[model samples]
Target chain A: MDLQYFAELFLGGLTRGSIYALIALGYTMVYGIIELINFAHGEIYMIGAFTGLIVATVLTFAGFPTLAVLVLASVAAVVYSSCYGYTMEKIAYKPLRGAPRLSALISAIGMSLFLQNYVLLAQTSDFLPFPSLVPDLPFWEPYAHIISSQEIVIISVTALVMILLNLLIKFTRMGKAMRATSQDREMAMLTGVDVNRVISLTFIIGSATAALGAVLIASHIGQINFYVGFIAGIKAFVAAVLGGIGSVPGAVVGALVLGWTESFFTGYISSDYEDVFAFIFLVVILIFKPSGILGRSETQKV
Target chain B: MASLIEIRKSFLVSIWFMFLTFPIMVIRVNTVENVIQWRWNNMIAVGLGSFLLSFVWRYLIRRKEQGVQRQEESTGLRRSIFQRIGEDRRIFLPGLTVAAVAVVVFPFLVSMYQVNIMTTAFMYIMLGLGLNIVVGVAGLLDLGYVAFYAVGAYTYALLNYHFGLSFWICLPIGAGLGAVFGILLGFPVLRLRGDYLAIVTLGFGEIIRLVLENWNEFSFGPSGIANIPRPGLFGVAFSLEAHSRYIYFIVVILAIFTIFMVNRLQNSRIGRAWLALREDEIACQAMGVDKTRTKLTAFALGATWAGLAGVVFAAKTTFINPASFTLWESINILCIVVLGGMGSITGVVLGALVLVLLPEYLRAFAEYRILTFGVVLVLMMVFRPGGIVSNVRRTYQFEGPDSGDK
Candidate 1:
């Protein structure tokens, strides 16, 4: 491809990858501490988008300013999704904390299915149009050939969130507690860290990030549905695993790689095989380097 | 079972339901008219249903607890009722004979619709038995097992569609292909453990489905291959009127063969190696069990049965599609194996019957069926992690105290 075409694909991929990275962070964080895939995390992202849509719709009807409406909608989405993440942990996961890994995995799958059907029964299964929250800026007209204002917003917002997350994990007390718990839950507990609270906080932050991702993706795609979570969740999970399951920066890098792969594969190859490419990548990675691109290989002692 | 305290618990449960149901169930987005829909009735109904169900469930548990207290006085009767049938060959022989006769007469006794459901259930039984070797016996979690079923179905479907092959001819081909694909998929994941192995298998499953869905030249794409030939006995066609009975008998035979094979394998040297591998992989390896060969054999054997089941399934349905072999179908088979008590053949059969037939009977609440499955899965795992008919540790006659003297 020519330079301009490549740039366009890159920009498009960056936006898509940003969303994947946000979702992957949730998977990585949960897996890091609890060693559970938390299969329902993707549903939280879907719920976040729906919550944002509702908030945006209500605000639009109320004739609020675009900036104010966007801010409120994002806040509402984050709040609602965090609630879902918290409740999911408390209800489905907490009881099976010390159970066998298979039981926990099964429970997570159950929760995923339950939430998917619950949403299906509550809302119509058909796709609903998501209200555009990106404010139209005439000044970006010159750059519109390469990247839209919406894409710019998505990329920048994701960058800012990642930076803030980095700061939180590095400089804050809660971050230390989280890291400690993930390293060794028993040790952390003995060292006076409230492990449960740390785990819950990890879920909250992870979920809030996913909500941000959902809102951004919904605005970009202009549509949402109940079943969207299943595929996106799986893809994001692939991205997470590709980056090293518990590594934060690895998730971002892995997601970007996946996004680029999907974009280019769709452009060059058949679009029908876009999802197939990601799954193929997962299998290849597992076979060649199962620790993932950025993850450390775990050694089990007999 | 009913008491004032029970009513209070039910009240608390209803309140919990109200919080959970109100937001999602009450305010719904209506896509058609572009408006929000108020589903107040559904919200209240669900909350009330949860309360009533939990109450009844609690009442049953209470009754069971009370029954246990009274069991001491009726110990003799209880002992007679639950006597060790496994130890007595005479009692077991008559029971087996009666069951065998009943199974042969089942299709004739039931309606055609029920017979058809039984056939489907038996197909799952065969699949469950196959998966039991890998997951239950080998302790390797395979999430993409439906891929084997797909391979088997498509083997028959394509052979029949292109060459006009008979079911009997294509059945072995399908099974052979299934085993080949199983080894192909299993080889790479031999070094991977547990969840990693599961995800890779799942990815492989998706890859197979994607290929079938997209490769129109080979597999007919999304439109799927239709009008596939059905299985027949000799020159006489098992036509529409006798369709259900013929398929039911065919599935019964296949299921029996699977059970017989798995039963034989479980006691053999390789089966012992698999059991040892499941208990402690390091020890099994130290004991000179070739991990690669044993695992591959487990995968191949498991896939072989799934292939046979798939051939029967394709012939019974007389059509094949990528949609029929989704990841959900794989999970359904996995659930049957796990629910039936992983290593137990009897448990697998019971699990398939209950799971498959229960959904068919609850067709009135079709939409709620999957939701119920989710609930049932979680409850089963929570209460009985070992499964419905958890495998009993085999006791060899040589291990008994008097064996040394003999």
Candidate 2:
């Protein structure tokens, strides 16, 4: 591959990886706290995309500037998805807290099906075009490659979100509570951490990040559908697993690796097997390193 | 006694309710015409059969309870012929006899569509039994089992298409490939347990599917290999042109053979080791059981069955595609095992029949069928978490010459 082509592939992989990392963070965070898979996380991402679409349309109709509309859409999508995530945890997941892992998993699957179908019923089954908010610029024309302005925006925005998330988790009281609850639910509860509230907060944070990802993805792809989350959800879960399910940095690295794997496979091999390549990578990684590249290995106590 | 009475009353109430609704439900079946009309009859037969089967099921329970009561009175412990049968007899003779009879007579009594469905159900039964060996018996959570099924199907398809191999020849080859993949998968995650193992298996399944899709040189990309040869008995092909009914019989025979083998295995020393591992791995290891070998054996055996089923599936369909071996398919087979009261052969068969045929029977519901199916699954889990026929409480009986000595 030429230098320019390699750079483009790397950039493309980085952008896709950033989105995966953001989504994987949500999965890892929720799992870290509750040991629940939160199978509906992908649906939440789907909901976020729709939320952004609707908000963007409304803002445009109201005669707002494109930048203002984008900001408004992002906020709306985040709020809307966070509420949905909170409700999911409260209604479907909370009652089954004391049940077996399998029971919770079944419920998660049920919730996922319910969301996917409910959305299918409400929205048209056909893919809807996402309105492009980014202005087409010729900044990368000199580099002899067609790189859209949207890609840069998505990558930077994702980075900003990750940095903000890291700061919040490291410094904030709510973040500390989340960390404590994840460490030991009983201990956290005993210490007046309000375990329920922390859990709700975690869902909100995860949902918000997923919403951000959805918006970025919608902008990149320029089309969205209800069923889009199913495969993407599986891929994101793969990313989380690759990154070590509960670690923030691990999710990012896993996502990048997955993205690079897909890009490389499509570039050198065939594009038809992009998804297949991602899954193969997951299996290989899982076999060699079950704890993930950066994840701490958990010891089982007899 | 109280619980038994409660169960009997509920069974009677459900049967009465079904009968009352039968006439109303009959109206929905009237829309289809000609050859399709047989489909309605099949539905009615299945419904009525299931209802009648419930009565026999209840009777067995009641008889076992009474026997237990007698044993308690005599031996000062709640044990009976039922317990003896459960503990001692490797084979569930009564249940197996019923299944065998159904397999034999189904082709004669049912329409081709129903027969085809029964064939599919049989395939699923094989898959579930294979899964039972791993998940239910050994207590290993495998989410990527479909990988082995894929391996078998792809291996058979490729070998047959490329080398002009017969379907019969490819069957064993497919199974061998599945076993190899199973061992490959088992080796790496041998140290992982529970969720971690499940995740790895899930990854493995996905990887296999991905390779099939991407490896265009061999798998022929998304457009899969078609017109694969069907299985033949002594050079006679089992197809629509040739005796189609005979094909159904073949499926029946294969299903019975699988059930018999699985039953035999479950009663053997290997099976005991598996159960021991499932109950408590550490304890099994402490008791001098080779945990690694036993776990690997479960994987290989389970994958072998799946592989056999996959080859059968490829032959029957005469076409194979990546879409056919999806995660959803894996989940569906898993659902059958779970619904059937995991570890119980009869329960798994019944579960497969219900799940596979329920959609066909409720064709009027169309799009809503899946919704209802999902609801039923959730309800089954909530109400009967142990499954419809969990044999945890059953007492084994001894009726042969060596009966009462123990």
Candidate 3:
């Protein structure tokens, strides 16, 4: 009955979901192609945020305009995160290509830990204040109570990224190769699709999206830290799993569901065990529907 | 020995790595003071590290490929040094005698501080062996193993806090409770596929920890239950130093028991069933193995050890907290099992020793313990998933069809 509170929670959920979707897309895309959970994706996001903060701070001190600083910071985040993602695959995942699935998974976990510490060692472990890049919109000031301008910008940017991602997957030659590879790697390789290149590109694109998400969220939250990636990565992985890991639309939808679940649960019920409740929700869903809501059940041939 | 092309590639790698680490490694920004400190030396370090490591990495990868190819081509698997030593009674008998003698004299030879450190290593050994059953033998990746360990720890802490129960009474109970929880977790994730188990267990671990953290009344919140008494013998009061030795010996005995039990279990039918289940779930079921029973036993038995270890952990530290039992703890145990050699008893023990003691002794490298663990894990999985001691499968040597006919 309370329209404002409901709208607030709804919008809040939407914002959270958008970020989750952004991070989840990388996970879903990587998992789709390789069937390996890119555990370091979250760290890549953290690195992006750190890079963004570093770039933005430097650019601002150099007397750059707000718009240029924001643009440059975001560009730096995307470019650097993509590079890290690509390098991580080449180093960790590529060598374990024919190994048991768990080996790659463990290696991914190792990579995750390594990246987390790498950032921690390089940057301060304490939370650094992130510069809010989203400017105040003149017209949206009236409705700022329900949803802030930052949230609006984040959601819109996320939506735009998703739309572009969808278009790329649907239309581009690389996208076609990616689909073919994910469907059947050997078949794609036989057709001279350059499976390795496709896999590398997938990681790059996924990392780029996650970096964009990290930049948006970090700016909105107004702080950044090395540990942020661990939890965010886990949540995003949850979202990816919730969405049917290999499916892009599934990831977005799963993220939205998870976001709403967290928002409404915290809004309506006890907030102390927010993470606990989210995890419990995941476990319950997995028990009843192991394939995930939007994911197709993979039938093992052997 | 390297070609020009290889050297050039390595140089390119160094350059790429320098550029890659440029923003984070080379730049440190202070927001409040607004000082952008450029640490350009970090770039050189990155470049050099990548350049040198790239050569070694490629060489290692090449060796691994050759090893794999050789293994595929050979009918008889080449036993690793550890395996050969294990199977050869002449060397094995002497090695066992030496190890036993060394283990018995360990506490007496070392100071209280060293004993405490050795106790900690023993704690990890117990935890690793327990997990070895689930992840290594049963083919289940239960990342939430710390939950069981937590259950064991909290059981003692709470039971002692509330009912004034002693450590002796609570040890069995903790181990029992761990098994019960294992089955509880196991029953739900039974139908799910292998990869799903890792995530769900991860969630389960987080849930347990979060519950303990938030449910202040139940788990005393994050500060945790403190001042729990150490394990006692015949109501005898011992000095702090003596208590340390006593607890160290207690851990030694329990660790030996665990090793004995796990070693036997590994050879048992149930253990074989668990192995088969791990190797191929469908094939195991086709062979009429009760996949459910095998998986459940693996989980329950594994938890029992973790539970026993947890009780000791509580008794040793005399403090319990949600923070102590984190996902990291579970992963730490996993590192030991994985780094040691998944299914090898000696490997797990050696893994525990190297992982726990080396860091303790090398105090300077303490800060980089986890960083090294990360590196070790990735490198181990990539290069030697079989670990330091590869498990040697029991081979039945008889006759081929043609040989038998001849």
Count clashing residue pairs in model 3.
0
What is the C-alpha lDDT profile of model 2 across B296-366, one tens digit per residue? 99999999988988888888788888888778777777778787777888778878888888977888867
Among all windows of 10 consecutive residues in model 1 chain B, the one with the lowest summed lDDT is B75-84
Docking class of 2: incorrect
Colliding residue pairs in candidate 1:
none
List the per-model TM-score of the A chain.
0.97, 0.95, 0.97
Candidate number of the best lDDT: 3
Model 3 gets an lDDT of 0.90
Q: Kindly provide the TM-score of model 2 when superposed on the true structure, using C-alpha atoms.
A: 0.80
TM-score each candidate: 0.91, 0.80, 0.97
Model 2: per-residue lDDT, tens digit, A226-275? 88787778888889888888888788889889888888787777787687
Candidates sorted by lDDT, best first: 3, 1, 2
Model 1 error, position B221 (Å): 0.6
Question: What are the runs in model 1 whose C-alpha is more than 4 Å off?
Answer: B1-20, B31-34, B39-91, B395-406
Question: Residue-wise lDDT of candidate 1 within A277-299, one digit each (tens)?
Answer: 98888888878988888988988
